[model samples]
Target: MANNQGRSVRQPTLLEVIIVLGLFLAIAFSFVSVVDLPIQLALFIALFLIVILGIRLGYTYNDLQEAIKSGISNGLEAVLILVAVGALIGSWIAGGIVPTIISFGLEIIHPSIFLLATLIICSLTSLATGTSWGTAGTAGIAMVAIGEGLGIPLPMVVGAVMSGAYFGDKLSPLSDSTVLTASMAKVNIIDHIKSMLYVSVPAFLISGAAFTIVGFTATGHVDMAGVESTINSLNSTFNIGWIMLIPAVVVIVLLAMRKPPVPTIAFGALLGVVWAGLFQGMDWIAALNTTYDGFVIETGEAFMDELLNQGGITSMLGSIVVILLGLGFGGLLNHIGALQVIVDSFKRFITNTGRLSISTVATGIMANIFGCAMYVSLILTPKIMEKNYDEMKVDRRVLSRNTEVGGTLTSGMVPWSDNGIFMVALFGVPTLQYLPYMWLSFAAIILVIIYGYTNKFIWYVDDEEEGQGHELDIASDQKA
Candidate 1:
């Protein structure tokens, strides 16, 4: 094919795209699951293969390098957030913020409702902050420790945290993914959120009910004595007080006010250092060291030491390397037209609303798997499918909603993706271990497909009412 500038460009064939993607997946899964190696090495191998594919497609090394750079650039913000979160976790633990929260949670929350409470807490935190990463690194960490104290399964706790965090992230207007999806589809952000409610609300309710039922079943295994022991260790080791919560309060207030997440989180980390010095009796230097190398304590209680002895900038280095390699692989695929070819191959099947919805979800998931970041999927999927929605007269809000359902919700399920890597590093739970329990993501995907086929809550553009604030027509036998 010839480009706009008349330069020759070889578009990848469907077979070539499949082979490349398949090989990457195989290598990644093998290294992570079978070989028990760092995911970065696997991603590096995959990236090298993609570079070879780009060369065979007539792209120069410079072109491929630029593509990789561009892809990494897109994820720089997330990379920054990861760094900030690492410091936040370390400092919070040192300053007794996390320990205090965990101690209070152990005392107040009964085992029968711990899972349900975790879901609600994480959902509210993410909704307020508009960043699932922040929520998970902060409140999510505390919840995991508390769940451990109560003898709840680690995977189940992590699953509830994941579901609640993404639930709020998908609906919050302040969320970068939500805003990007709306912008790509050329729709109002509020309309985009309202459109998502048709699916998100149902998913939230279902997930909550499931958690409640599961919590009841799981409480039979509760270890009350262990919970008390953990709480006592927390109080004996750190100055567990209401004052320690100031750092967390500041973070939430700043983020809710639309402050930049990076600075707000950094400030929160700094506050943690100050608290550690004042309350924990650590000198300024030792307190600051915790931000980079992570907090350490010899509480004599093995479980307490294991749970509290985590966080720091150094802790996130491995995940950062994986993210960079994953982004580079995604960038090279786009540069060589591999990703585009895959999407084009699906075009023929998207002949109606139902098929379109399915294709959009599939493409979003594919983009996350290949692009290795939620931003990549959120930006690329809607841009690719916008014209199709317009031609079919479907409301752009629906396009935005489906894009989020597939992209934001599923990002954490892919081990190499930014969200997935963060989750694994923070909670020490493998993506596969928690995949079956990600109720919100699964429910949303199923509901969107059902809505498409049933013609319920599907809106169409009305040419006659195109302007003057006229309402669009909802394509449903039942009232929307």
Candidate 2:
């Protein structure tokens, strides 16, 4: 009894596994159900402790400690990226990027074609901003109101925004999820994007076509007053100009240079502050305030103000908490050995590529059901597939593609997830209402699974390309 904590590491017990699963479920459910509460943080600290407990009970001291350190280290870049994104978003609005995007969105896209317009405009905006949340808060909201004015179904509008948001989110260099997925799978960013288009390309074409047909048939006018009033308010608050794009151009160039996202975004935000102070005529103090503290304005119409009155570092606190807690859940699993136990239990049964793909799909779905978070699904998949991937001699990117082809794209379909909750609140449409129209995301998943079984376009890395020179030693062993 005195030496139990000192005993060598052993297999994780079933109870330990349940604790890991339970932590993920609690954080996901609580965060979605109650966004105001920091249930994610609560779960993070609790899960962190649980891992330590699991280590004391079963894992060796060094193994337990090292896993925790490694897991946290894995998320360091993401944590930096998150903070930089928050600042960039805050200052971008202050610098007129968001307002400019919205003004253009309203100028050309009419309510008569609002749903299709929403999908198209938001896809472009998300690609520009590299952020789904930013597009949703800015242009997406404006599109919703326009869609509503046209008497379009809220479900269709939300589905359209989601489709576009996800499309850009999947490919944008600025996107944390995109960067994270590519890096974790050890795939080059360009390779990951190209590989994903195999499935995403068709899904995108079909989704866009469907929205277009529906828009052509749908008819009604938007509240021009509200749309115009909001743009006017934006124009008043910030000096909008084509020159406003300098900061954006600088950011894009930095990303193209393959600079890390954190520095690029941070420098972009700084450029935004300087632009606002000099070109936009905001005081230096005011520029800084808007950059860090969020800018609010009474656009006369409360509805318009609600749309524009957002941004700053503080706003992303909730997402940050959720992410840390999500990663904490992952850390706990790795610490306890329960994650490995679960994977091993599955890997023994997998015989070929077909079964492995099927299992991956199931893993993604189950992760969604349990965590109710798409990114969390990413964190869990590498655990399940790491060993089988090594055994099958498949490329890591193939495993990564399977993880995301479904997992990241399907979050909005879950009524209990954050994306679903946000959608429902944004448009007052229930998740069930938009489920049918979210064709692309669902279609993508199905196509991947069927294609996996049929072995169509399923490219695997040849032994020659498995250039794990230094990393191979530490890549996929059950022990490390």
Candidate 3:
């Protein structure tokens, strides 16, 4: 048999394309809301429809299978990281590490400025950790509890946390999305991050200002009693102290030293297990179980039980399944030439720099919606748009930055995406409820498009000359 990669096929008609998407969405909505199905199942049902479409398009089952494998490969790394994060969460909570942070955060974070502080703190934590999932699951959960106790709205708080987490994730050299974007565009991670700041920073500033205003103007009265009770419950539940923070600090230090994410995060989890045994007086078997099954606090208070009783590799299973199914759906669509047809159709309207950039952003957002994860979007967007970038003589850094803006920053905005599901599970807020509040995440995309048209910080390659700048770009891309 011959290889099927790059084999030309009939492009899908616009009506056919809309029909598939519409069917998927209709099924998704039904399963997600009407039947009360888990997101994984809903995505699986949608995936089956796409596979059926591929069959109708004359693709063999083998070709579809191969495409599915190839697509899942793009997100395999993220799956592993998410699993490790689950283990980290369980271990950290059981070992009192997360409890210690929550305890301290509650003590120092003033109610009047909590939203602003949440933004900064989450940004710093995500910057150090390089994982928004990790930041959201750990500090984000704690912030939810704190915000509720402060009588602030959950949606607003989630927005602030998400904005910060994504901001750091987009810019952090250690982030998988950041690295993946730079790699796809053939640019240095550092250079890619530097270019991103032109859009990311301003969006963040505006978001911060909004949070600040909300903090001051929020009508909710502070439940001081609830705050004290929650803090006291945390203090009684774990061996809360400064020493418990050592594991998180160690992970941050290792990240600063350019350590890889998997081992750094795994080690942090192990440190938590050790702390559980040493400081929390937890049995070795119990601590080990925590890594597998997450922390279990039988606090009488529902909020505390919900806040503290999450984590473990087991908890991450649903998300892993959703990612695989979502990627598989996209993979099958790509295999059937459905997605490629959409990309090609856009080329006709992309007649200039601004249109090209806008199209790239549009494709990225579409990838996020259809691909259902940032990793998949990042991979697909560049594959569909990089040639256009090269043809336009635009620097790959711009493409890299735009992908982060359109894809990475918008992943959590999608209702059923892996990142969105994770946020919903972590913070207990629906994606739509928090969507409007993620001003920074949405703003980054807008700012980039605005900059794209204004010609601000947009770089281009020289076609006729082999200058030092070109050599430097080549060198940077090589290092990345």
Could you arrange the candidates by TM-score from highest to lowest?
A: 1, 3, 2
In model 1, the runs with Cα more than 4 Å from the true position are: 1-7, 463-480
Q: How close is every model to the real structure, measured as TM-score?
A: 0.95, 0.72, 0.89
For each candidate in the order shown, give its overall lDDT on alpha carbons: 0.87, 0.66, 0.80
Show the colliding residue pairs in model 2: none
Query: Largest lDDT belongs to which candidate?
Result: 1
TM-score of 1: 0.95
**Predicted candidate 2 versus true structure: per-residue lDDT over 25-58, tens digit per residue:** 6765566466745455556555556666665675
Top-down lDDT ranking: 1, 3, 2
lDDT digits (tens) for residues 371-431 of candidate 3: 7877778888888898898788788888888888878888898877778877775666888
Per-residue lDDT tens digits for candidate 1, residues 83-124, read 888898899999999999898999999999989999999999
TM-score of 2: 0.72
